[model samples]
Target: MSPGPGADSAPAPKPHDDDHTSGTAPGDGPAGRGTFSSLGIRNYRLFFTGAIVSNTGTWMARITQDWLVLTLTGSAAAVGITTALQFLPMLLFGLYGGVIADRCPKRLLLLFSQGALGLCGLTLAVLTLSGEVRVWHVYLVAFLLGMVTVVDNPTRQSFVSEMVGPEQLRNAVSLNSANFQSARLVGPAVAGVLITAVGSGWAFLLNGLSFLAPIIGLLLMRPAELHRTEPVPRGKGQLKEGLKYVAGRPELIWPIVLVGFVGTFAFNFPIWLTAFADKVFHAGAGTYGLLNTLIAAGSLAGALLAARRGSSRLRMLLGAAALLGVLEIAAALAPSFWLFAALLVAIGMVGLTVNVTANSSVQMATDPAMRGRVMSLYMMVFVGGTPLGAPVVGWLTDHYGVRVGMATGGAVAVIAAVVIGLILLRAGGMRLKLDLRRGHRHVRMVPRERLTAVV
Candidate 1:
């Protein structure tokens, strides 16, 4: 998920679902309470803490779901197909989801979505525990879960600003990433142990039960603390107007493009890991979980860094993208299991840096009126890119070998850096070059007129 970007001095609402009230007040921020400490706010604190607990279960369920499918089917293709099904709805419904989010009461909408997710988790647990589960059952459940996510993602994103206001929006978003990534770390490891001990069914049950936290958080929040908006317009112009607004700004457009490219192409750690543990290393589920753990650990650290640096910078984001590519290649060449895990940690750190940074930049830069639509675009590419890349990546692993497949993605990422950097430069009305000879990469983001006149 992307954090809303920019607006450093004031925490302002992003384009919100008109129903949310971003309740900013006199001297609200200077009291050391809004942005950095919005978590300290009465309403947001409850919601944030609740989110942390809920997110852990969500990650746990995802890990178990993938593992369960793989264990029963023993087919990588099945995993890929199911993963594709889970995300395909995002690609198809993202725009519509944005529309729904922009028009609905985000809190109320989230209540329903979270409940659906819990029920989905419970149903999966029951079916799987019964030992009557089949491949199709997993697929159907995954598809339903994906459908719920289509409704859930934008609403949840748009809801944060309502609770914390725009002053603390960046921090709230960063903390949210931190929360999700922290959950990512706990969920997978716990799922691994549980799957190896009690069974995957229990993990699903835990996830189902976890939804209660967020549901309660929603019920407890004070609407007076939220940013208020006029009634939602059902105008046919909503989508078109939002797209036009997004297309018009360089601050916003560049970051969205950056995230779209990187998210679609580079941040595919899960599918790539399957190849690492199974094909290249010829290992099993334990090794797979360990690899994910290493990556999640790195990502958790990256989230922390982003949380501290609440401002957005395009140069920083691009630099992270470049570093992420370099690490991908390094991970591919890791000589042993332990070394590979170490490299994966580095890969995860840099990958999350790319992810969190790009996400923060795009979300912050977008217009408040169109945040839902813009975020949907961000997520649509981030998740949608998987369906396109996974099958191809899986095929490459199957045919060309895992090392080559991993290397291929890394190489593409590197090429993307050079290409995207130039694209951003040219689009920014500037020409730039990167120098790495001084034992560090130094890039100067000079203006177009200055660079052109120099030549």
Candidate 2:
């Protein structure tokens, strides 16, 4: 569930005076509102709108990029390599990016990072359009994109608190996921059509141009309305400070650890889906795109449901993760394409529940002054683990067959969820309780002391 009020050592940062203009003052506006309440804030509304366009483009690029790698090499491992290259920088330098985000103006940092990201996309587009693109060229651009993401991801993540304040942070985070998943529903379908009709290059070109929407949105934001935090002054050992902070808090540490396991071992969908499309189903890029769209549909639904919820619970997080693993395993063994595809939708829903719950819970538990570094470490473990997982999953798919690879990932997720859940229970002096009586709650976690007293 929720962490205690004083979970972090640092005092919570006060909202800027201009935050009142954004309509997020205590007991007013979005404060005690419903699912779409965060959108009532003008600044967040702009950020959300721009994100819709940019995120759609991002999904398009991702689909096109993976397909291009598959087309160029015809090797699943190569696709894994592309994925790995894209996230490797986060593994190496993610904490440092958090430090930068904490020390700088987030809006300014976002401007530069977003511009650099657009440039990276444009460069890739030029290469593809000019017929000069090679696998190495794609790899180069992916790495550069990742370098920017090391800073961009943390800045963007922590910026939500400023836009909406703590009152609406979870709502905004859920809506952000919803926005991305909604784009997922559209981007792949469009990419499929483009790849089939025009070419992957045009998809790449469109993705490059899509960044302009977000850039323009950033410029239009009212800086005075933001709930700004005092930036952490530059200093040595700040990374270590962040690390130590997380280490001491079970609420922050366990969620990050669980997500790390799931992210690294279970979230290799690109590799798994591509292999299933080409090898198992004997299908083409369109099938790949369709499968992605199905997942997005489920994820969007999950995100919307999460937005309506009042709080994030660790029990829900663990249950969703375990369900995701089970669904993945079932999908791996499905005898028909339709059955497998159906399982993917369920997988997407549970997977997103796992993500949104962990993200919101962690953010709610963290101190604002430390959010950048905390979120950076969060993103690093979550996304950075990809480099380690993708190649291994790819190799497994290549040698052991797609079913084995998929099932193995699911098994790892299930194991991680169980292990981490148990660890948390033990640390909290609680135990799982099963009640097999009518008109009673069937299963729950109860404090050991309570159980002893009852006995």
Candidate 3:
């Protein structure tokens, strides 16, 4: 049923090439390496280290950018617009960017993309430090950086298997999430202090400098050690081919749809959190940073837990999404700031569960030849909806108040989870039943093929 793109067009892979499986079990070569197995590979180690530096800088920039936008305009809608601009390019070119990743040398492409991103950061830094930064300046740089990310995001995702073969891909993906979460924990706290002590300019400048670590790491990677796949040859209708490829697979399409809904409506944390800090809590940047750090703390734990698991399953994904939605709703109704913050930790954990499971499932289910395209489609839908949703969510928060805004996202998420879950259940030819016998009650979804219905 995995009707992927034309695998016949792809050349036979080398012996050292990746095995196209969802990386659940440990690979024979690295069975002894344990949970940190991906780090044992020299190339993955280099990439991982570099990623840590860059991701930290990215988080710093994110906090600074949102705060700066608010400071300049005093409008949540303006902040939302900034977020929208950053992701708008991905909505436009993300699929095409995946095609480019498949056709080009990923390592080389990353070098250029990373360099461009750093330059954008630096330009923003200079403008801010000189007191010449305007709202347009922020908007322009966000869009430019996002344009570069259109290329960078999918390439980086597909590049993981190159650094660590498919056997370790699941572990690698989990570790990568952990790394990013780790950065989330540190970057926001640091950005807060720096913003208070100096200004947003220094945070931008440091992030610009952080790019050098990845650039240097890329240069240091051993080309021969990489488990490289041959680039897809240039051909007409490749993008169409990718769409058709995903369309044929239920496993691929379902998660993407589920994530698309969650990402669009529920993942507007920047808008939600900032409004809470400014409006509800009536706090400063430090409190906002604290809010971020708590979520990151929970997310970090969730990532570690995911790393411990050998496989990501569909049940995990659905359950996590449902839990996340419920928690989000609960958080929205919190009577106090501390209660809301505590709920954030649980929200972070459930959110990561959905993310890690969906990501691992898609990558594992996809064929090697079509990994880039599938992942690009994954990124496009999963992230692309942000541009369309952020502004709307921002407007809601601006007019209806933070609680209503949060509640709106929460309600949408819960509905999406229930709808997607029912669709998947029926697709599996099953129906849920509630049974009460001997004063005990239970509920379950039974397979239609196995059931005898009483008339």
Please name the candidate that would achieve the greatest TM-score relative to the true structure: 2
Locate the minimum summed-lDDT window of 10 residues in model 2.
18-27
Instruction: Count clashes in each candidate, considering only residues at least 3 apart in sequence or on different chains.
Output: 18, 0, 0
* lDDT over C-alpha atoms for residue 217 of model 2: 84
What are the lDDT figures for the candidates, one per model? 0.71, 0.85, 0.84
Compose the digit string of candidate 3's lDDT tens values, residues 251-282: 67888998998888888999999999999899
Better of 1 and 3 by lDDT: 3
Worst 10 residues of 1 by lDDT: 18-27
What is the Å distance of residue 113 in model 1 from its true position?
A: 0.5
Off by over 4 Å in 3: 1-33, 438-441, 452-455
Q: Give a tens-digit lDDT track for model 1, residues 1-455.
A: 11222232232333222111111111123332333466777877887788888888988887787777667776566667778788888888877888787777677788899999999989988987888888898889988888888878877776666666555666677777777888888888888788888988898899999999998988887766666433246888887776787777655566666666666667666667766777678876666777788888888887777666645556666677778777777777778878878888788777777776666566655545566777777777778766777667666766776676677778777777677667766765666646555664465555656553322
Error of 2 at 116 (Å): 0.9
Q: After the best TM-score superposition of candidate 1, give how far the Cα of residue 218 lies from its true spot, in angstroms.
A: 0.8
